[model samples]
Target chain A: MERILISGPADPRLDDFRDLNHSDSRPDLPGGKGLVVAEGPLVVGRLLESRFPVRAIVGFKNKLDSFFASFQAENSGVDLSGIPIYEVTRETLATVAGFDMHRGLLATADRVVEDSVASVLEGARTVVVLEGVGDHENIGSMFRNAAGMGVDAILFGNGCADPLYRRVVRVSMGHVLRLPFAHLEGSYTTWQRSLEELSQAGFHLVSLTPDPAAVHLEDALKGRDKVALLVGAEGPGLTEHAMRATDVRARIPMAPGTDSLNLATSAAIAFYERDRSQRT
Target chain B: MERILISGPADPRLDDFRDLNHSDSRPDLPGGKGLVVAEGPLVVGRLLESRFPVRAIVGFKNKLDSFFASFQAENSGVDLSGIPIYEVTRETLATVAGFDMHRGLLATADRVVEDSVASVLEGARTVVVLEGVGDHENIGSMFRNAAGMGVDAILFGNGCADPLYRRVVRVSMGHVLRLPFAHLEGSYTTWQRSLEELSQAGFHLVSLTPDPAAVHLEDALKGRDKVALLVGAEGPGLTEHAMRATDVRARIPMAPGTDSLNLATSAAIAFYERDRSQRT
Candidate 1:
């Protein structure tokens, strides 16, 4: 890897790293020359392993050396002979990013096109489908939980936030980048068809709700081989049509009259329960 | 309840209800009257049932009326004859609270003195001890999880946040008001003494961690008649001294190299495991 020294903030080579806090929002603009950014050492490492094309690496000297050493250790055949690593002081890096701290490192990569829903669901056993979960933090936490609990893939339905959004990426601790997810774009009929496909593939469509009339989660998930857990936003919850479409309306036994748990937390528990039942 | 019509923001009777967003922080100030505040209809309803003395209720006319009807239904003998129920437009309520869109209702109540740790643990089988958890949202969720998982009480250790903070109250969905909890204020010595007391009362002290070497959570809780689950904040986790002080260190099975689960979520899973084991 080639090392470059950047002493000034206005250097054109640093353009991809400029005003990153805001540029993260317009990643699709400027003929889609936008960079997919990974912050902190851990996330940066994940970015390196992802399918996204690496553009450049920027960090302090120590971080750059440490990252390069680890990269070399992980990949022996990969020739990084032409890759440029820009080294700058922490203060300069923070200024270039328009933030107070840089979390020690940052990397820019070309955004890869997400796989289609059909591709994401290929050979999947358990999956999560989300609707109207517009909160980025909630979305990120949900993906992290899904990854941790061994959910195979995530599918986003209508009214969802951008998973590639910076806050979501950060909150998810970069699990959004690693997890296999795809958008389901189109009308409600299209969503219904996609869900029907999963159902045809023998996935039990479990709609998670707080409705007392729904079967208990443990009882509902019994003997299921393939399952798709459908979760909605916290307050309004799943739309009536979506709930009606599911095979089973399952609920975690919550204390009576309490507001439903945070969408992500509820989903995590549901995933954990499913994993436990399957293991048993 | 006496329906007081306060048409203006300058009314003295509504003083306790002013600037609620910042009141919990500066409790020493006049506006920060140390009054316990409950927002939204559900939480306000719980505040009414709590031991805290209701000081006043300020909200929209319909909301106030509905609350009054519920109060009358639940306690026919209690005279709310003179307790002021201020009628205001939603816009006016928002202005007085220093925010837009009041969750349709707000109530002020005197903070009730919680029972001592000893009193809270009387005849209790399980309790949660928290240390250095200064986040109100985490504390609130902990209380809610404790209630749902049948944990008996919550004991706050050093550096813990105030459970009555408005965000905590809102996040807990009024469970903080319904559940029993107390502060352990003396010192490390006092905290240790409390644990010893709990041990004498037949509770097992189990500290939750992500350490791979620790016993599995399910294995640790098996056959335990009484357990005290200790949890700490997300990043720093349980202090070394605290970890050593516990009877056993138990770990949730996590994917290697992943960040630990959120504090509240981790606590909930531990509580869930304990409940599941006890049932068998």
Candidate 2:
């Protein structure tokens, strides 16, 4: 492992970790070669193992050593031989991240080209379809929940936020890096074609709605081999065109006078039911 | 429906609705009235219908009219003739709230001394027990989820945030006003006794854990007539003492290498499963 000591925040070599909050907006951000910044040891560890090519890491020596100890003792198969680990004082690290909290470590990497919907769904048994989910935290939570619940992949309709945005990455607990995802081309009309693609691929597309007239979730899942659970933004759910394309509208039975559960929570219930049904 | 036209934010009668963000802590600032402010027409509507003594309300004519229309059309049974409905300009409304997104209405009510744990449990067939959940948004979401998933009530064990905090009230979509909640006095030791109290009252105490050895959620809910789902903060879950008092430990059955689901999401799943089982 290569250890580089950086005493101040001004070193040119530590440029990858400088002013991270504003770095994403740089025309050169992430995919453009400015490097994607990951905070903390957990996300950094995930980034190390992800398909994205890691450039370098910056952190306090203790955090780096603690991270390295895992590989040494557990033989975790993670290697950091050639990657630069820049050790900085806590104060200098804070200055670089532009905040007092950077989880005591940060990692940067080049963003990989996104996978197509067909590729992400190649062998997936269950997938999540999201529409107009523009909120970053919700998107992140959805990915986190999706990963925990064993959803195979995620597909985005129009009006979705960038999954690689810093907050989204942090909120997803780095699951956004691990989960396979794709964005559907065009609006609801072509998004409907995407649904057709799923149908042609032997997937049962079920849109989750709050309407009482919709079929109960349990009933919607009955007799389905491969399921694609569709969710939309919190207030205005799936477009009518998208809804008309789905096989059926399914709702988690809700108590009276309550708004729909948060989008992420709604998707989680759908995912949990799907996961539960498979084993039961 | 006597509407009082208040021209400015300086009016003494409109004091309750002034500088709402800081009003909660204002034994020292703002209106000097320590009232809980409910924002937007929807929450004001809930506040109007709640048992909490409403001091006054302020809103635009359109918002008030829309809210008034609901009561007239639905026979909502809320009488607000004596309550002062202060008509304020949108500019004044934003100035008072310290932000432009005021949702077109705001209401203030004296904080109700919280209900007892026994009272909240008296009729609750299913409820949630939270421990060390310090996040306001999480608390609010739990209430929203609790209300939507048909959980009867919520009991706070230890280290819980105030559910009436403005951010929480807004995040819960004002379900905080509609859904009933109680705080259990004392620490985990007495909180454990509270769990015993629930058990003696015929509520099955099931603690939600990420532990692999725990009974799966579906199996934990089997053959139970009444259930109380125990959840803790996201990272450090239920304290061992609290877990010890639980009748059984239940887990949501997450995938490999993933962290525990978010606290509110975890509770929502448990609540949904309970709601589903009771119906089927």
lDDT score for residue B125 of model 1: 82
Q: Pick the candidate with the highest lDDT.
A: 2
Query: Local error of candidate 1 at A94, Å?
Result: 6.3
Q: Give one clash count per candidate, in the order shown.
A: 0, 0
Residues A1-280 of candidate 2: C-alpha lDDT, one tens digit per residue:
7799997988888887677777655355453334566777778878888887888888888988897777456646767678888889899978876888646888888877889888988999999988988898999999999999999999988888878877888899899999999988886567667678889899999999998999999889876899999999989988888888899999999998888888899999999999888886
Worst 10 residues of 1 chain B by lDDT: B185-194
Question: Measured against the native two-chain assembly using Cα atoms, what DockQ does each of the candidate structures obtain, in the order listed?
Answer: 0.38, 0.87
Model 2 chain A lowest lDDT segment of ten: A25-34
Instruction: Determine which window of 10 residues in candidate 1 chain A has minimal summed lDDT.
Output: A26-35
Instruction: Please list the residue runs of candidate 1 whose C-alpha ends up more than 4 Å from where it truly belongs after superposition.
Output: A2-22, A26-35, A57-104, B7-10, B18-21, B26-33, B60-79, B88-101, B185-190
Off by over 4 Å in 2: A25-34, A71-76, B25-34, B60-76, B90-95, B98-101
What TM-score does each of the candidates earn? 0.87, 0.92
